[model samples]
Target chain A: MHDRISSLGEKKLISRIISRSRSVFGSSKLMGLGDDAALIDAGDDYLVLTSDLLLETRHFPDPGRPRDMGWKTVTVNMSDLAAMGSRPEGFILSAALPDLELEFFDSIMDGVIEACCHYQAPLMGGDTNEADEIILSGTAIGRAAKDRVLMKSGARPGDLVAVTGPLGVGAAGTELILSGKSTEGFEDAVERSLRPVARIEDGIILAESGLVSSATDITDGLVSELGELMDASGTGMRIYEESLPIGEEVPEIAAILGMDPLELALYYGEDFELVFTAHPAGIEELSTMMDIHVIGEVTGGGSIEMVDKDGATYKLQVRGYEHLSPA
Target chain B: MHDRISSLGEKKLISRIISRSRSVFGSSKLMGLGDDAALIDAGDDYLVLTSDLLLETRHFPDPGRPRDMGWKTVTVNMSDLAAMGSRPEGFILSAALPDLELEFFDSIMDGVIEACCHYQAPLMGGDTNEADEIILSGTAIGRAAKDRVLMKSGARPGDLVAVTGPLGVGAAGTELILSGKSTEGFEDAVERSLRPVARIEDGIILAESGLVSSATDITDGLVSELGELMDASGTGMRIYEESLPIGEEVPEIAAILGMDPLELALYYGEDFELVFTAHPAGIEELSTMMDIHVIGEVTGGGSIEMVDKDGATYKLQVRGYEHLSPA
Candidate 1:
């Protein structure tokens, strides 16, 4: 009689939703649920649509700056479009607020505007409502060339897996904030957590070059993202533990928290880095254009494994940021 | 130093938000923040985008069914697109949920899917997150011919104002719910409040006829909607008090609750009726097609007034469901 959403888990909930909802647009809908962004055929290109929600205390705890919250809300949705190799066009926001100071609301709007300007995404329309707590939702709409759109289900068995930037910065920043530590030298990590930039340019370049076979953004940690790609493409992956591009300060921060740097880089989410599969020749070409680390390679089977320098492999756990699962 | 959002009011807050956000798309954006929906040029047609938020206590109190909540959420956003005379293409939802019963979540999904299927709008993509309370946000995307889309600013002097259907049923339903009265006899009112329908067909018909001068959905009741149209078009209105198409049961419900039916009809939000302006010939033609009532006429001045049968004119107050304002 276990019928609660918590028992079903987030993935199962999503699957149930997809199963119940049928596409009415027919072939005009290029992509639907279970993808990074929904794709709709728009004559010359495919329109990308995605949404993300951020709640108070859950997404950002007390003493969190309002501007940061606003910026992060917009950034999360932008990251979805970035994963699809779509150019940021515009976004609409729906926010619910409790009784609060006008300065707080102003600061949040300022942050959202800053992020929109930074990404060159215009603020199109929005709704404001009253609630018991602060909740922000943003939907980003973008466009990409019909053939150049990146997908999570396009990876081949021999494709090389790579990341656009360093990992664990977001986790490190969260730890710093929760611990109330001064971010003097770890400002980069703090910034990464508060105002992380989506890999829009990198995705566009990779897509246009036609080098990347499949792509996804690492918002829910590295292993979880790889698992999604593997699940969608019906392929497995072998990741090298030492090949992860961990930030220099991550080790020190993890040490202070009495946690392993590698574990932090692996399990901690919200990194917002592009994790993609590319052909070896494409990887060679992309390496010259941008800094990308070859962290893994796609395999034929349906299991994700991590190999250490000692030539031993361990099965990777499928644990990341699931919404309704038991903590 | 009084900087509370409540003091600034919802209108001022929206103005502040619009002032801070700049448009990046330029000419391609046919319409922006202040309209019912944002319009962007998409080659042959214009894409209409709008978003709405629904919170737990603010939008729906306890004893409310989960399916109704989901249905209302989608309906509210669809109303926005309907006001713009846009055909709904698809929608993306972002929901924040607390640890709740599985049946509650399932019921909500059922309601949302029901609405989407009824409207022929597909559920494209969504994000789910954890929160302290249930918060749902939906972004509706639609398409409309560039020249045929109705706008709030298209009203001209001498245009006749009309409403598609009866009003005050939503208010009557809310009153019944708050009083815990039996809904056996007032089932229609209860249904109106809980499962209000968006007038999508009426909007499409009016837009196709090319006769309606301007259009807006009465989500915030009749008075507030007229105020918006007046403000946007720089025109005034003179409404005949007796012309309001009040629901048959609203008067009885209002009398039982010791309230005036006219006041309830004027102020109660969530009616979801289409309030629009048309030429006299257009009104004559439309009256033959649908149940549209001629309630008022557009004037030259920039003030809205209600004229009684005795020829006395009273300035109408712009009070409706405003968020973040004093209760």
Candidate 2:
């Protein structure tokens, strides 16, 4: 596979990616993209580093579009920064391409460059190699105020539950793709699956306002992510089913696929949307930047409950990607 | 591929890698490895991050041997860290496994763990997915003392050239492998090609000594790496070919294959040895380390030359791996 990929000139693709990346930060970087390794400036504080890998058949859906694949790789890590309430500074991209076709490779880079531009984060450095399947990995670095970083373990029992943006669009769109259905009129819904943006700006704003008590991105479905937040924060949450904001295209695709819209919303993964907790007083301030709906409230019990519109309540069940679950 | 990988239990090979990682530096890291995002101890310093990819064919040999493949993955990045003279504290291993067997994956981890032990680095995280070929991408983080990290551009015209160990054994052994020759009595030599080790300790020592002016690992052959050092430093060098250290096992393989030993030593890549430049005063202290040898001298000529054994000189050229070079 490496030999097959070797036929494609990696340096050319890397050169293109580097040229497209703009340096928004100052001149402290001793070396950036295009070098064998990157050199950065570190002062008195500790440096934060993280790396993520997106396989063609793992972090994304099979038969996934290539441009979306590229976008997903970058946004996922950016979402990590959002969870930490860190302002992204730069990231390093490493990709293993199956072939060396310049046109195909450029399209992938175009998607990556677009995300970097959208987030105002520069491409610091990267590695490009060839493999049988397309593999993308990124290491992102960000900065945060000393006492302002949000954590998954900081939620209190009385914290208000909120999420940035609606749910289920990405998973619903993916269901359509699986059924050989057209997504022409539902570009936004499909894009939610392909190019879901990370809520970094919202996270930073909430953190700076000293309003957010805890934060985590919804990579897994809503219920699964909520479970993680609950486990981490040692508190349960009570959510109202009617308050759930379903995407416009979600119900249509869910109906066609014979899937429950609420179930789809609860189980849709890779949304890269932020689910955070704050005090009731902080809710109005956070809603100023974007409409953050109060979906629920943290409870003392260690179980999540959903109150249906029929005035019945039940334990929320999560069914999504679990790292240890059998295939 | 992404869907297939995502569907597979996350706790398979990659989670195992991450589970072994230890965060020794601090306690404020909210997210380490398990979550979609990692929360780091983002203090005052700008984070230092670097990544390198190991391709089975380009970085190692074909028909990959699992242990060496794993070792090469770690050593390549270690060399990158050595170039910057940074102490690698953490790494994220992202891999695309061609085969998901326990034995094959275990052997790869054995190699990575060996490297971690040697460098005193920890595997803080990783991502795994399936591919047509085996791929390893490692993102390493190290805290350098302020901005005092060494770079390739630190060399001066009056500096002395040095190498950590003998070269060409790896290349010669690889030649034997490619030619389907017998590995009669040269187990050590064959191991050089298969299990190349990086000069991480040497890098740390040299960085501390503050003697080495510029440094880079011999990944793209001696001449190519030297060319990089020259390009970065804007200076040239004159290497005494007679002074080159060829491993004892290298000569036997060279004689059996009827290849020029000197040419093999100079142009053959994948040495993973450290090639550095230092001041004349540091030579005595450098010799304290085992096998440290001064093989050349830096000059203002902006080109590299080799002075042969018979009082003859020739311009050394780079025929090492280039992405666009004809295979």
Candidate 3:
């Protein structure tokens, strides 16, 4: 008795597949599935491996320039390694592309090369094939000290929840592009959406400083990421709606789009910012070292609650970026 | 100027991409792009990384069972590492699938799990997305002793060229399937094509014995692989047509299909067998250890020739599986 994958959804389908799979390396693997990346013991350090897939019309609806698409492809995979607090080592890219102009291929590769150079991660090798549309898959490998590796399952109750940078910038940028508005004053938002940077250095700093108890990256909105952290850590969270670190242009863009600024900050994803939990005593030190804002506290229960400024509380919905759902 | 990708061809397109991309790791990387896989120096051993893309129609035109497609997907990437004489460790699989029956997804994952278990390569974490068609990408990470890794650019003149197993079986299998012929006596050939095995043990044996000077797996026919070995080693080859290893059912299948068995042996691809070069003295030992057939000898010049039984020589055409070619 089989059901449609659309009915199961992406998350349930992945969980089913992972449940059916068995681990070949039991002892040597530090972390296996369900984490941002897999970690294996490599003698002196832990090697991190992660893979990401981006499809045309799905990941990038209007991938304006090929170069930007290439850059985003690598950045997305690298973001996983950043969540694990690993140093970028290298990546192998496999692309299934349609018959396009050579200039388009060149532009896409230019973006890939530029991003590699920027991150100091070399392009090792890859495979290319012909397909109906552009589908890019990148597998990034990195290494980290075993003691300094960050995990989502290590949060404790009462830990302060924080973000490395402001949220909703990527979502605002997406709005500008989709609305066909001039990005004169919203350059920062558009750039954030088009070229989101992985917070690799910040993750490393948090992990090395022994400040972060649990960490994950905000690719699928703040609430979604917090839900994952809570699921992994077996903890709940109390988030302050007023404490959300929203970018300056987010509110203006939200007003223009007739959307709630707080809703955008809580729901819009692809920020690629590090969301981590730390002890309250270390919050000031973390803020002094980097642009971090305390937004919540890990609670004892297993439900997420958002408190408004007027002392009203609402249960945050678990909806985020879901793939394979009917539009 | 914009040119169509078809005119540039797949190989040329890859070359252009590799030329445009730069290596971020200068001294630490043992091998970068343009190899079976990239080799990076770990602390004690070399880490091998490779990625391969498989599309639904392009890769598996008649992917009879979902399990077979999944097995083939992982097998293809493992074969790349096999060419490098690296031991299989783990792999990350990223899939972009459309809304399909749950049985299809289950069968595919079953095949992937079975292959991983068989190869002892654990399944790490990966990304899944929705697409118009089924697209699977696998990135396999492996390890090898720094001195024991095989490379394509190490063959010297007078080295004997050999293959691990019979050639033409995969081709004959394809023919049988395409013709809808009976498989009473051609079961071996059909199995070869449907479930080809990667010669991982033979590769490791050859590498550990210090016998193989250069090696690569036969995924794109014998002549194409030999051509790559020749180009990488800066040498030529003289192959004996009578020495071509044809399977038992190949001749009969060729007779039925009105095709030349020897031509199929040279041009048909997806064998997943190891082709290597070594000194004449080591050939006998290698043959004793494995089912290796001596088919040719490396020469000083840069051209490939095939000598028939009657001593008539013909210049072998550089025809292999070329993707995106105008048929």
Per-residue lDDT of model 2, residues B222-289, tens digit only: 88778777876889989997788987777778888899877778877768788889888887787786
Model 1, span B1-327: residue lDDT tens: 857887866766776676556444343443646778887768878888888888877777444598988888899999988998889988777777877688888899888988988877888876677777778888888888888888888899999999988989888888887787677799888888889899988888888788988889988778888888888888998899889889999999998889988888887777888999998989999888888989999999788899987989999888676788775
DockQ of 2: 0.11
Candidate 2, overall lDDT?
0.67
Q: Which pairs clash (backbone N, Cα, C closer than 3 Å) in model 2?
A: A56-B1, A56-B2, A57-B1, A57-B2, A57-B3, A57-B5, A58-B1, A58-B2, A58-B6, A323-B10
Candidate 2 chain B minimal-lDDT segment of 10 residues: B30-39
TM-score of each: 0.97, 0.79, 0.95
Instruction: Give the true-structure RMSD of model 2.
Output: 11.5
Q: Output the better candidate (1/3) by lDDT.
A: 1
**Shift of residue B253 alpha carbon in model 2, Å:** 2.6
- Give interface RMSD for all predictions: 2.3, 17.3, 2.2
| Poorest 10 consecutive residues by lDDT, candidate 3 chain B | B21-30
Off by over 4 Å in 2: A1-46, A56-70, A177-180, A317-319, A322-325, B1-47, B55-71, B98-111, B130-134, B173-185, B190-195, B255-260, B288-290
Clashing pairs in 3: none
**What is residue B72's positional error in candidate 3, in angstroms?**
1.0
Per-residue error for B264 in candidate 2, Å, reads 4.1
Q: For all candidates in order, state the fraction of native interface contacts they contain.
A: 0.66, 0.14, 0.71
- Give the docking tier of candidate 1: medium
Candidates 1 and 2 compared: the better one by lDDT is 1
